[model samples]
Target: MLGLLQRCLVRQGQRSLHSGRPALMAVSSDSGVGTTQNLSESDIHQDIDKRVKKSKVVVFMKGTKEQPQCGFSNAVVQIFRMHGVDDFDTVNVLQNEGIRQGIKTYSKWPTIPQVFLDGEFIGGCDIMIQMHRSGELGETLRKAGIESQISDPPAAKDTTEETTPSTSSTNVKS
Candidate 1:
């Protein structure tokens, strides 16, 4: 399990390594998730819809999985890694203002680091933390078609590094 955890972290780090951050070539959405140019609100909604549906597990967060922009996001990412969820996708909400706000409206949850399982909103960091703490996250992941890969439910690990910003934690609106 520890090997799995490390591998996930390493993969997360590598994912951001090759992202071509060139200036927006066309009208593409700020978040790189969209395949087309900047879109209308409805179109953005469609993009988001497509995004969540594309993967069994996805997180709409402040930054990419390689580098989470907030401590809460890091924590959530870590929790997912600890649970052996290495194949999940993440959207960097900070990259696109529309996505940042759009996701809030899409999920009707006021927060970044939003999680989706099987195309359903699983809530934000707070809810994920609650699920992780109560040992429900593992079961939820398995039920959602993501493999838990653990013989027993493991505890959530704090992956927030030293420089992790000092801000309100999960569930605390800051």
Candidate 2:
């Protein structure tokens, strides 16, 4: 049954994690049936390439942009939202096991919630957080032809009112 296969896949993933190998999960083919197949590396690469180029900004996360399934994914979504990037493409890796693993292989990064700007890998959640804090993310988005909503802090204002000193005011000796 599918449940048994899923359990086996989970155990396999756990074993791969402990064995220092990339985890691999089985995914159904595009046939829309319950049948599954082993995707060739080239096929996965092609699929990932198409997805990366689907938009100016692409995110491979655990869930959709509207509803993230994990904290890291949510963080990625929030970072984009902060940048006023709402039209970016999002691939829910949780819905496709092949993509979930294939993305890691494609980017050579061992994590989920991978971000791509202009079809280039930009790293994952931690990297995104670092870029967001360092203001690099906004700049990067700008360079990618995508403007960010975050703006520079306003200059400090002088609160003191400009007024002529009264002649009657005596200067105090310090």
lDDT of 1 by residue, 1-174 (tens): 444434654664555455554332223233475443477778888889999998888899866667675556766788887777888888877667778788888888887889999999998877877787677888888787777754455556767674688677678576
User: What do the candidate models score in CA lDDT, each in turn?
Assistant: 0.73, 0.73
TM-score of 1: 0.67
- Candidate 2: where is the Cα deviation over 4 Å? 1-38, 153-174
Clashing pairs in 2: none
How high is the lDDT of residue 125 in model 1?
A: 73
Q: What's the lDDT for residue 40 in model 1?
A: 78
lDDT of 1 at 152: 50
Question: Can you tell me which runs of candidate 1 are displaced by over 4 Å?
Answer: 1-31, 34-37, 150-174
Weakest ten-residue segment in model 2 by summed lDDT: 28-37
For candidate 1, which ten residues in a row score worst on lDDT?
Answer: 22-31
Alpha carbon lDDT at 142, candidate 2 = 90
Model 2: lDDT equals 0.73
